[model samples]
Target: MISYRWLLFIVLFVGIFATNYLAMTVKEPLAASAAFTLMVLSVYGLEKFYNRGPEKVTDERTDLINMKAFYYGSLALIVTLMFEFIWLVSEDYETAVLMAKYLLMPFGAMIAVVVLSKAYLERVM
Candidate 1:
């Protein structure tokens, strides 16, 4: 049987991909937001299912791995944002909000991937 963690990973990856694709193709905020909402719900549900109720003990290794992943992911996001800012400034762009939103996509995706990986490893190993 496939683990819940792998299911979550697949859901998140597909959701993000579909959201971005729809955002680009349809250019509809509502559609993109719906896709994002699905991703968030899946993650939350998996967390609750795995760590709460009958499963009283939380996985320490999963937590540690998630923390480490988050740290590195955040650092990389910061660096990417800095470079994007530099590029935007060089190009004489004045849309700070837009730039921030653009940067958020990758950052959010990275966090999702990290969390999914931790959950997957926890279940498999």
Candidate 2:
């Protein structure tokens, strides 16, 4: 099983190598870098599925704790979304669109966290 540290190192190394390769071989490197990021994230996602561990008990106590953590995480995500929204609104439409593109991943992650955590909370609580 690949541990977190090794996964991190592998992603980091591939990112650096891909970036350097693009810099040396391509006229523009942004697309290559962005592609590398998506690739790395995809790999990490596959790793999660491949290395998924055993299930645990879903008792009320665990649900309560998880619910609290989800609430806090949601609050944090809300704050970040607010900040990004404000920043996006302050910019021109083109700039706002670009900014939103960068924010999309975190927003999606927050949505996933909320969905999964609430699912678990509802299942137990």
Candidate 3:
């Protein structure tokens, strides 16, 4: 059986992927927003469940891994935004906005995966 951490990651991955796919296919702002919200809530719930209690605190290594994940994810998001900007200039603003909106969930999911993987590796090996 997969560990709880890996199961959580898989759930997050699927949620983000589904959200992005829905956003792309539905082409409705409200629908996209709802999907995004669901993804965010799922992530928050996972974090809460994994952490177990309000009084528990994060360690330095966890903080560092999270920071590194954010750094890398931000870098990737920036590049994607730049590409979207180029697309906007060349194609149309609406298209670029749609692409960017669709990207947000996956980018967030990527960050979660990276941080969790780092933490899991630290714990196991």
| Highest-TM-score candidate | 1
RMSD of each: 9.2, 9.6, 8.2
* Model 3 quality (TM-score): 0.43
Evaluate residue 37 in candidate 3 and report its C-alpha lDDT on the 0 to 100 scale: 61
Residue 19, model 3: Cα distance from true site in angstroms: 1.8
Ten residues in sequence with the least summed lDDT for candidate 1: 84-93
Off by over 4 Å in 1: 54-125
User: Clashing residue pairs, candidate 1?
Assistant: none
Clash counts per candidate, in order, are 0, 0, 0
Candidates in order, TM-scores: namely 0.46, 0.38, 0.43
Q: Write the per-residue lDDT of candidate 2 for residues 10-41, one digit (tens) a residue.
A: 77687656644554455234554464556556
- Cα displacement (angstroms), candidate 1, residue 76, comes to 19
* lDDT against the true structure, each candidate: 0.66, 0.63, 0.63
- lDDT, residue 94, candidate 1: 55
TM-score of predicted structure 2: 0.38
